[model samples]
Target chain A: MSSKNLIIVPIFNEAWNLPLLFERLGALKKSWDVLYINDGSSDSSKELLEAQGSNFIDLAYNIGIGGCVQTGLKYAFEHEYDYAVQLDGDGQHPIEALSELLEEVNSNECDIAIGSRFKRDKKHPVGRTRRLGIRILSSTIKVLTGQTILDPTSGYRLFNRKSISLLSENYPQDYPEPESVVFLLKNGLRICEVPVRMNSREGGISSIHRDGIFYMAKVMLSMIMVVLRPKESSHGSR
Target chain B: MEADNLVDINRVQYIAIAVSVVYLLAILYLIRGKKIREEYSLIWLLFGVVFIVLSIWREGLDWISNLLGVAYPPTAIFLIFFMAIFLIMIQFSLIISRLSRNNSKLAQDQALIKQKLEQVEKKLSEK
Candidate 1:
């Protein structure tokens, strides 16, 4: 049977970028369906998304990035989507990487495929502090799970049916990307990273960019907690 | 001599007992007025009862202070009060977190329902 793919774009106050994002995604060659999750934007993002006439889930309030993405996953799970890809609405994640990510998951090579900026072409120049934070998290995951994930903080990810069910049920709320990698690894789920070109943000600032130090500290603490927490035995989809 | 010192209740102890009684009355009034949920106010009530108990039985406070190696008996009361407040704050934070999660889930569910309803309405109009 052919797999059904759902591209989940979690947006928060990215009205300016939506037009270009919609254009780029619309031009994709694959027949994957798109679902946008509006994370309670104060701007006219909801109206703009509605005008697009695509599938979308509107959150009542700003529940942060993790909650917004998890809502998309829950929608995919309930709708019985075979595979779901989490794409950012900021236009930073290139639509070209979608094919490679979906191909990895479709071939059963890995249950979750991550688009890494550092894999092959290191074109995206990251700030020093943010780069250090990413390094710390990546190293922590390696030490704990014996797996090397190049970009643990990347939002560009594809999840198979099993991962969708598991994450939809229980996902980390704050700073979920790295903690989720640890959780998936501890549960014996296969993860692979594919090299992808990431563009600079076209509009809006990152929610975590303001408090870099504090955010890094919290992420480090969360990584420790993820490792210390007891393991789950069930690996299959519920 | 120490035993007598423990049994002796001073003016400060009387003031404490009076304050505890007033606090307990306020909690009861709030509960009666339906301003505070019973489940949430239970901890406050328990704290008020503990304060009254400690004020009435001065000897018990001294015993506890000595057992815990605290130099001053009043320090023991302050320690317990702060500990209780900290615990109550933690409980409230946990409740807020759970409520936020449920709120987000409800919003997501509502969005899904709205989407399905729209689809059905569109189909009906087409037919």
Candidate 2:
């Protein structure tokens, strides 16, 4: 149950960041194993992932962020890892603050720790649509779960055994962040967000930016449906 | 079965026509998607149409009912049930066929991959 066991980073069409991310990860490679969940990146991503020669999982196609994250958690759960963290392939997440997050999980500071940009300790992208949309989603999640999460859409998070087991069993299929917050809380898991610096994208346009204003509304609504739907009654191996 | 015996069989025709008509319309509405394009939904849809027409044509149903030595509405109702089961069986067959095709393709790919890997190993050993 030590913290420096394993971490999974989900990447999609993020070829530019891979080399730097891998270098950053190489520093943490001694005690931690990194598993990259490749989400059907039609770039040199698959080639790099294959050539990089590290532990990785390849999804059938581009199932988006939710699917990419879940695939990593599923691997961690099946392989019986002590801990798992979601490192965004986009390089927005600050990997320098990784030790702090790991320490929090290891000491039972929190069963799961999320990296928050809203706490003012970290720099965030200056986009009105993203800010406003995440704000709406956070408020709705608070109402649903009675817990006001500071950054419900943050991709950076560290999860212990309980957190990974639950997510791997039945994680959200779409727009998962807010829904996972409610899901973990409802099941009595301790969750909190720590302020962490989030950089702008290194290269290439994100899918969210491609859709722009229209995507903001669609994603916000999608998150609500995904988070608030009654959990399925069926148990054991979906 | 006990509930059926409690009801007067003479009033069956009046209720049967009403129930059959409603189900027929529902089946038709579901088939609206099929009308736009050739859909797998057509199989159930075409059968539903047949059941609707047969049930409504009272004389044709009555003659068949008389020949079968059963009450008219009950005959039509049972026939509709049978048609539904038949469609489900057809869908099941379609799924089975698709799976078999995928299974064969996967096996072939795996065999080809294994052969290539073995060739690579042979070359490495020679080097």
Candidate 3:
């Protein structure tokens, strides 16, 4: 087991999937430690994260995906882990992709590796509208940061120490995925992607509300605003 | 206008003004905090002062209300009260949102501290 290998999972009200998520994660037991940071969920997700008996950090409140992931990254950085992989609790992310990410991190000097389901299988289940939305954001991220990313919205990613340090300090508060990609690239970190298959959500409803389509427009506009804004350095006094 | 009732109304107006002045002083005392609670109180205080002035200036009150097309003084007062209440409710919602955040955070912190203590105790026992 490598000393610095880590997988950080952020959980929020995904109690139904926690048991299976933990089982699959435990089966992989390839010397990687799992850290689940439970967002302020009213459900038993907190109890499940605690019961799973893995290392975790409990957030103060519902800080959304951006803040939850940031909390996990901060823990990883403070504890000096070499790499951190973020897997979703909703069971859509593939655990097998962990290998591909590790390979990239080890063989290549890549700072971050993302799992691109759409590019991988060409059968990703995202609706047409969503595909369009994601593309606009992906291309926008590319233009803003001069970095090409296939899946800017992927929650499944592996970050090395440098990437982790960069994100832990400066993360977007709103629709964080596309905005975060820009942030990473603007800070001079290279991002690469590996194809990984993802399944539809196994349990619990998607957090995207009935007005989620509307949310995409809002996210798109906000991402544009974020890209337009200037970024401060990681070492700069925040 | 009945003479006795006019005297009673005048007395009530004076008392109301006095109360409003005291409220204004109290709001000034704690405006530094400027929190939701204080803001709510400030709204009430301002309304009190406004109501006091309107009550004393009967013709002026009627003129403003009539200009606004509200016939009844109580109706105008009710309308303002409802609007102020709406603003206060919004403030209440904000406070609830903050309270929920504090509750979740304080509980998580407590749990973390307790978990660390248990880990310490387990290590001591193992040693």
Per-model TM-score versus the true fold: 0.90, 0.64, 0.70
> For candidate 2 chain A, which ten residues in a row score worst on lDDT?
A229-238
Model 3 ranges with Cα > 4 A deviation: A1-3, A205-214, B1-26, B29-118
lDDT of each: 0.86, 0.71, 0.75
Question: If both were scored by DockQ, which would come out higher, candidate 2 or candidate 3?
Answer: 3
Q: Give the number of the best model, judged by TM-score.
A: 1
By the lDDT metric, which is better: model 1 or model 2?
Answer: 1
Q: How high is the TM-score of chain A in model 1?
A: 0.93
Point out the worst 10-residue segment of candidate 1 chain B by lDDT: B2-11
Greater-lDDT candidate between 1 and 3: 1
Off by over 4 Å in 2: A205-208, A212-238, B1-127
Query: Chain A of model 2, TM-score against the native?
Result: 0.86
Q: Best by DockQ, which number?
A: 1
lDDT of 2 by residue, A1-238 (tens): 3443567787788887889988988887467788787776888887898798766666556666776677677667767887888988878788887777877776666789888888765346647767776777788777777788888877789898878888876666555777677777776779877778777767755444566666556656665665566654433443
* Per-residue lDDT over B1-127 for candidate 1, one digit per residue giving the tens place of the 0 to 100 score: 8887887558788998999999999999999999999999999999999989998998999999999899998899889989999999999999998898888778777777777788789899999
Give residue A214's lDDT in candidate 3 (0 to 100). Answer: 65
User: If you assessed candidate 2 against the hidden native complex, which CAPRI class would it receive?
Assistant: incorrect
Ranking by lDDT: 1, 3, 2
Look at candidate 3 and tell me the lDDT of residue A204: 59
lDDT of 3 by residue, A195-231 (tens): 8887787865443344467667766776677667676
